[model samples]
Target: MRLSRSFLPTLKENPAEAQITSHRLMLRAGLIRQTAAGIYAWLPAGLRVLRNIADIVREEQDAVGAQELLMPTLQSAELWKRSGRYDAYGPEMLRIRDRHERDMLYGPTNEEMITDLFGQIIKSYKELPQVLYHIQWKFRDEVRPRFGVMRGREFYMKDAYSFDLDHDSSVDTYRRMMLAYLRTFQRLGVRAIPMRADTGPIGGELSHEFLILAPTGESGVFFDSALEEQDWLGEDVDIHDRGSLEKFFTGMTSFYAATDEMHDAEAWAKVPAERQREGRGIEVGHIFNFGRKYTESMDITVSGPDGAPLYPEMGSYGIGVSRLVAAIIEASHDEGGIIWPETVAPFRAVIINLKSGDSTCDALCEKLYAAAPEHFLYDDRAERAGAKFADADLMGHPWQLIVGPRGAKEGKVEIKNRRTGERTEATPEDALALVMKTQG
Candidate 1:
């Protein structure tokens, strides 16, 4: 995409309302704009990153045999009433009314609706093990929506539901999701520790919240320091292998990890002094093994092998997709701006025309754009070199290729890695080759 044609409203100064690094950088980079309190309109650049993150999430979900389907943002309140949570959900539920006075709501979560949908179609144990997921917008009426998208009242999320006929099989499904979640966050370049957490309004005895440690985070967490060194991406995970999945789950949970609500002083004291890590963390994803909570309430029953009616065991997994955008910034950015993981960067690399109108520099940039295999944001706008440099850094592409008269005359361009601040002069072909390899 050409900068001259992009809808990038780069800001000169930080927005006062944005107190967090992610919020400030997001505003300065023109990735998003506040449409209302806690609601945002994702601009072109931000949308690209959002789509990239969604794609990665979809791929990981698919890897675990979870089928994809989109659910509606608005749901009838009758479904929640059936699950007995309509009244229990409290003010966070954005209750609405249609013109005919029927109770409606912008969905905060989809447990009730999904249960109703599953109950109508599934009747036998043959379809017992199934996972269905959707990526969509959700709204919660947060009385105090703050911290930009981190704690937004409205956000995007990927929620998956798993149904199984027996407790043993349900545990298998939960383990698969736990492994998938670990891989998902690892690929996004965030170290998320799975901490036992309160089920809250979701209501489940077995729950885990995958948290990424950041000083500006809202949740206080305690864990073993070994989690920081353990590598989740070291091996390929086979989600269908029950034993392997179980082993991974057991291994990961063997460490001492819990949020403040679940913390035990006795357990904390048991850990060797050097292994303890207490810090603030952001909850990026959560998973729950609710067993038959919704299924029993909503009459989602399947026929057992013995021909008896039985409620299907169930689990729900959620990843706060929009909140991850903020979480990533909080964990990775430096003083300059965001340093995006290559997997989620809006663009792989940028082509900066240092001398915008200069014939040689312009020709070099245009040639690079025309020849490159991947999309490169060609900065052909009438902006100063310093401004272009700053914008490139704030935009957080993996690489920046700078073209100037001096470099063009010497048949070289300045190639920079955004994350490491590494710059080197290279021939045009060499620059493209480096980018191609890194992108691959």
Candidate 2:
């Protein structure tokens, strides 16, 4: 993608309304624009980043046997009424009325609707263990929505529902999701610690919130430093094996971690002072073992082996697909701008034409552009070198390939690491090879 041809509307000054780093940078970098109080229109650059994140999430979900199925944004209020949660859900639920005067709503979550769907078709235990997920927009109508997408009233989320015939199997499903969540976040270059959390309106004794520590985060968290050192990608996870999943669970849960809602002073005090780390955290993923909460309420029953009606045990896992962009920026950005992880960056490397319109520099950029992947954004616009450099830094691709008359004359291109700020000069072919190796 050529910058001159792209719709990247970067700003020179921070927007006053943006209170957080992610919010401010997202606006300044032209990734998103606020259409309303908490609703945003994802611009081209931002949409690319969102797609990258969503693809990673889908890959991880598929790897764990979860099937994708999108549910409607607008739902019949009758579904919530069936579960006796119509009034209980409070103002966060965006209630509405259709022309026929029927009660309707933009779904904040899909428990009631999914339970209704499961009850309608899944009658036998043959389909006992199934995981259904969707990546879709959700509306919560938050009273004081702020902090950009972090607490947006309208945002994208990846929500999955798991159904099992028995309690034992349901717990296994929960564990599988936990492992998958850890793997997903790890692959995105973020280390999220799973901490015991209050289930809130979701109603579950067993719940975990995957938190990424950041100063501007919403949740206060305390945990063992060991969590930072553990890597989920290092292990071979077998989701079908209950025993193996249990071991993985134990290994991860051995470290003490808790959100403020579930914090226990006595348990925290027992940890050695050196191992304790208390800080603010951003919640990126949440999983709950809600048992029969939804199934029982909605009468989603399956026939047992003994021919008795049984309410399927259930759980739900959620990842804030849109909020992750803010969380990532909060954790990774420096003074310049966002330092995007290669996995979620809109472009793997941005080729900045330092001396655009100059014959040698323009020719070198053309060569690099031809060799680069579709994801690479070539800045061939007629902008000053400093402006191009600043824009490249603000956009935060993992690598920056710069071309200039001097470097082109020497048959060399400069490749700079966005995260480490290390600059190296190499032949164009060598630069391409280095970028491919690093991006992969």
Candidate 3:
């Protein structure tokens, strides 16, 4: 994408309303704009990042046997009423009335709706073990929606629902989701620790929140450092194998980790002081094993092996797709700007034309840009070198391929690593080769 042709609206000064690093940087970098108090219009650059994150999330979910489907943002209020939560869910629920005066709402979550859908279609135990997921926008009326997308009232979310006929099978689904979450976060270049958490309105006895540690996090967390060292994707556990999944689950839970609400002094004392780690963390994902909470309330049932009516045990897993954009920034930004993880960066590298009109610089920049037009952001704007460098750093492409008049004339260009701030001089072909190698 050419900077001159793009709609990026980067600002020189931070927005006063942005209190956190992610919020301030998001505004200054032109990733998003606030349309209303907690609602944002994701600009072109921001939308690219959001889609990248969602794609990774979708792939991980699909790998774990979860089938993707589209769910509507607006839902009939009758479903929540049947689940006995229409009234229980407080002001956060945006209650509305249609032309006929029928009640409706923008769904904050999809538990009751999904339960009803399953009850209608799944009548026998043969369809007992199914995982269904959707990536969609959700709305919650946060009294104080601040910190950009971190606590936004309107955001994109990926919510998955698992249905099983028995308690053991349901727990297995939960364990599988836990492993999936670990893999997803690892791929996103953040170390997210799974800590025991309150179920909140979800109403589950067993729940885990994947918290990415950041200084600006809202949750205070205590954990064992060993949790951060586990390579989930490297482990030889098959997602379809029950025993393998159980073993992996046990290994992960063996670590001492708890949110402030679930902290136990006795458990904390058991850990060696050197291995204990405490920090503020932002929640990126959550999974719940609520068993029959929704099924029982909504009378969702299927026939058991014995042909008896049974309420299917269920679990819900959620990853904040939009919030992750901000979370990733919070966890991995420096003074200059966001240092995006290559896996989710909008572009793998940015090509900066340091001397735009110079024949040599233009030729070199055009060559590099054409080599991988889709994977590179070509800064063809007629701007000063300083402004070009600042915008490239602020946008946080993983690499900066610099073409200056002198370097271009000498058939040499500079390749700078965004995260490490390391620069190396290379020919245009060598630089393209390096970027391709990183992509591979």
**Candidate with better TM-score, 1 vs 3:** 3
The residue pairs found clashing in candidate 1 are none
lDDT of 1 by residue, 269-344 (tens): 9989999999999999999999899998887788989889999989999999999999999999987788999888
Name the lDDT of candidate 2: 0.91
- How many backbone clashes are present in model 3? 0
Q: lDDT of each structure?
A: 0.90, 0.91, 0.93
Q: After superposition, how far is residue 53 of candidate 1 from its true place, in Å?
A: 0.5
Estimated TM-score per prediction?
0.97, 0.98, 0.98
Error of 2 at 113 (Å): 1.0
Q: Per-residue CA lDDT of candidate 3, range 342-438, in tens?
A: 8889899999998888888898899899898889999999999899999999999999999988898899989999999999999888888887786
* Weakest ten-residue segment in model 2 by summed lDDT: 229-238
| Highest lDDT scorer | 3
